[model samples]
Target: MPLTAALLVTVPVFLQAPWVRSAPMAAALFTLPLLALALVLERRGQGQWQQLGVLLVGFCGSWLGGCLFWGWFRLHPVMHLPIEAFALPLAVAGLGGRWRLAGAFYLGSLLGTACTDGVMAAAGLMDLWPQVLNAPLSEAPLLLQGAAIQVLHPWPLALVGLTASLLVFVCRRLWTLGGTWRVTAAALGTTLAVDTLFLAAALVAPHLSGLI
Candidate 1:
């Protein structure tokens, strides 16, 4: 999710006149929300840090492995799906921490995914399909592939950031306060929401044009 937010925020800066010479630094600074949950919910126990480290490694390793394996097989490489779905299981089994944080992470990842997609749309890189009605924001026709936004799109990318961040906050806050498995279940449910939205959009788009 942080990656999504970072990409959305950074891509537009590069598109503008000055170009973001310090884009990476700006990205790191802007990612405080992602790190904040970990900081505030720090566990205090015997070798807690060690456990956290292990959890991080295992979760990341599992996700990367899954992604690589899927991609190598020409599977439609998934995006936020793997990270959100597996992160909780890995953390629970490996680190044995509170489910609350896992819930937060998943919800945060969902928000992040939306932001990433929004940014990609704003940058003319991809299409959000059904929700996007504007021709400028509409995706490429079905036959096209890659980089749709080089025509100097006039739409501001800031809208993506603003809307995505708001959604993320709402989801994340709900996650922090929700029930144990319920939050996890909610995130999993949202994964369906995203997929359904995509499918509906693709079905409705004009057959001749490519989807962004």
Candidate 2:
């Protein structure tokens, strides 16, 4: 779990670096090593193949979604959030009786995202909240704008932590539902719920303002 967490946290940070960020293929290429590691680790476990399937499905879904929305269609990167969030959990839930594994993937992914954002904010690469909230819903990629990191604020951290916890709780509950359709419904609903909560917090809260 620790190794997995480390990979999850590190992969996003590495991919988001200015040079890699400018090169989409490089970012995708860098993810391969981590994906390989994840596969090796899961193969040693009980649900080895199932877990591997989950990882592959998640990666493909996220990559394809990114290509379609952020690349071909030119949608705002912010709009990709819910799709990226839904893909992994939905794949895990598809495993039917393996809610524990699904929950682990869901939590791990959220932890990774939060850790990446925190690290980027600390390194003065980006302002955490405004980059998310003020993101244009048209064609801009949020992290590539070269905006100076704004003054560190406490509220966004608190809000992010709160939202992460809430998402975990919701996912855990979703895992308890029976049937693939039920799980899918729960996963998609939770995705929208969390995204909405994040957007609302970023927009309505004064202390969380950014250059957007």
Candidate 3:
């Protein structure tokens, strides 16, 4: 299924995170252990360690979801949206019934991609001379797309991280319930806005300079 490839792609990307920049081959090997941890966290239940388990699981699941969506669907250029945008956010809303939490998951995945891309870009990974469009050429178009994401609609990496954090935090604090559908509606609305913005920006980005 998509989850497998998502996990596969997530490994190297995390290892190649702009911050680390390990050799491509080595990065894959490095993330093998994390892969196992990801499985454990994903399967973890709501017991004493539930919070921590899901926290780690959310990160991995979101990351894997994005990678799998992008690789499986072949949504290139701007893979941030189509990749993991709808599915995972919807999952958060469905599973936790918390808009803030779901929103956070959406943004956190974007943020993860953003951080990976940003670190690489800063380290000269994106500086490679190759562009499908006319803008600044980068090595991985996915990374470029990650860099291009925004906080409000298009959903930047920081936004994802913040949203996920808020989701986890608020749920724990308030422990509210009975608003599942409302939260679901809000989550869907948020996804729609992000999709609209991404499409609009994509069309306009070609004509503009580095504004994208």
Candidate 4:
């Protein structure tokens, strides 16, 4: 699961490189590694195929839901976060085990996606449309210039981490309160950890590479 998480977190960053971004099939090619890793992980009994499938579907559904909602109502992007936070847990709940792992991976993807944007922004490598809608809405000016990461300021990222952590900790205390509360805590906690790791990478990698 950790390996899968790592791959999920790093793949987006890999895809953001100029050379990979230029290749029409780069995204598909990059996904191959994840597919391979998923297969290996499943074989090792790290997680079931159903869980992985659920995670992927839930993750994709979150984006699709956002797009559809945005298209229909054009709500502020800030509104979409709550929608996703609500929808994702519901989407994974049916899987019936420690499904928070799925949420972790899903959120990990968000982190990777964010880090990828940050790297592109620092390197001036972004040339395509923003890969995630949040980037355009949150960092409109940067998007216009074919850059990314303008929205990845530390405070907002830290706030998200703090919120997720608080929710998870609070939920843990509520486990005896109900199943729903327990699940919610797991989902929020896992998501928070994954997001923190990615945010840390996004903030630090640029400095390490002298891109900032």
Candidate 5:
């Protein structure tokens, strides 16, 4: 269940990422249906459905955050995390309540995001963010590929390895807690997996990398 919850975090990357890019308003509005579904499931009164509902509620927060940021602030690299963290306060408060599942998942995803952005900054790829995004469609892939290649340099590669190791360590520790912590662990682990795959895609096939 925790692993499944973790994988759910990636759904938005495939669906919301491109959708928000093309139709920010529509993407933002889609949050309503997701929230409605969550409410319905929670009200069903079955344990399994109620749990799934809680996970979906967490996913809704992530989905809405992505839409809010990628919709209007894609070009501003600096605003990315701040915007993505729009639900931070709520997520934190949800930690000790019945909504711990939601809190764990959101925080895990956010941690993954923060780590990814930190790596980009440390690896000198931050400057390329706006450049690639604002470039012509034909030109963006090349710019993205160049940025990925930079990751192969000795210093950047070492930093990537170090950051990944730290995240893995955290995930292992979280897994031992055996409850919502498991959910957090799974989400964080899946996030790391997704980031690795996205970087690989950017290097080999930037057009399919989902950034443009």
Candidate 6:
């Protein structure tokens, strides 16, 4: 379950990120097929496949939210969290039902995104977001690298350390609960890992960071 949840969190980085950039409507529409497959698996599949269906249902929510925001609201960095959280009410309601795993994964991913955005805001990187993203492709990498380097300063580095430590502690606590909480832990932990890698990429190879 943990491995599957982790892959679901990571897959969007490679697949959805670029796809949404060029074809937002197509990316958004793809949710139908994903949800269809998920429903089919939930009805006909057993054991692991059934579990994957539930997770895919959750992924569809996240994927759609991402496509909406990155597609149209990318320039408005401040709207990122709100747009990505469009399914918050539904996810919360699903928590006590059979789709608890889906809720867990979505909530975990949302929490990670919140924390990342909070850290970025605190580190003063939020102000640079539009500039870096809107810059010409050839120039964006340098801007992104500069933004990544800014985090190396003492204050931003301290903020990053504190946030990372807090998230790790939360993940460890969630891990102790077992069951669906483990799904939450894995999703959150994988998101943190991905954010770390993205930062590294922004520093060393910003063009590959997928933000552009």
**Which numbered prediction scores highest in lDDT against the true structure?**
6
Worst 10 residues of 2 by lDDT: 143-152
What TM-score does structure 4 among the candidates reach?
A: 0.35
What is the alpha-carbon lDDT of model 6 when measured against the actual structure?
0.91
Q: Tell me the lDDT of candidate 5.
A: 0.88
> Model 1, clash count?
5
Q: Report the C-alpha lDDT of model 4 over 1-212, residue by residue, as the tens digit.
A: 34333443333333333333244354334445554554454445443564554344334443444333334322343343454344555444644654555554454444333443344344443433333333434454333323225434565445444555655566467455553343334444444454455445444442322111
Q: Is candidate 3 or candidate 5 better by TM-score?
A: 5
Winning model by TM-score: 6
Winner on TM-score between 2 and 6 is: 6
Model 2's alpha-carbon lDDT is: 0.43
lDDT at 146, model 5: 94
Q: Encode model 6's per-residue lDDT on 42-87: one tens digit a residue.
A: 8899999999999888989899999998889988989999988998
Model 1 over residues 1-212: C-alpha lDDT tens digits?
A: 22222232223223311222224334333334434433443444234453343223322333333333322321222343444344545555532454343433344344444555545555654533322322332443432212222322355335543554565566566556554433433443354345334434444543323222
Clashes of each: 5, 0, 13, 0, 0, 0
Model 5 over residues 1-212: C-alpha lDDT tens digits?
59777679788778778898889999999999989998888778588889888888888888888898889988887888998899999999999898888888889888988998999998889999999888888888889899999999999999999999999999999999898899999989999999898889989999975543
**Candidate 2 lDDT score at position 181:** 30
What is the C-alpha local distance difference test score of each model? 0.38, 0.43, 0.40, 0.42, 0.88, 0.91
Ranking by lDDT: 6, 5, 2, 4, 3, 1
Candidate 3: residue 14 Cα off by (Å): 6.6
lDDT winner between candidates 1 and 5: 5
Instruction: Give lDDT tens digits, candidate 2, residues 1-212.
Output: 22232243233323343333356565545557655665555555455465544444344444443434433223343444454455565655645654444444444444434444444455454533344434654422333322222222465445555655765665466457543333333433444343444345444443322312
Clashing pairs in 1: 140-210, 141-209, 141-210, 142-209, 142-210
Error of 3 at 89 (Å): 5.1
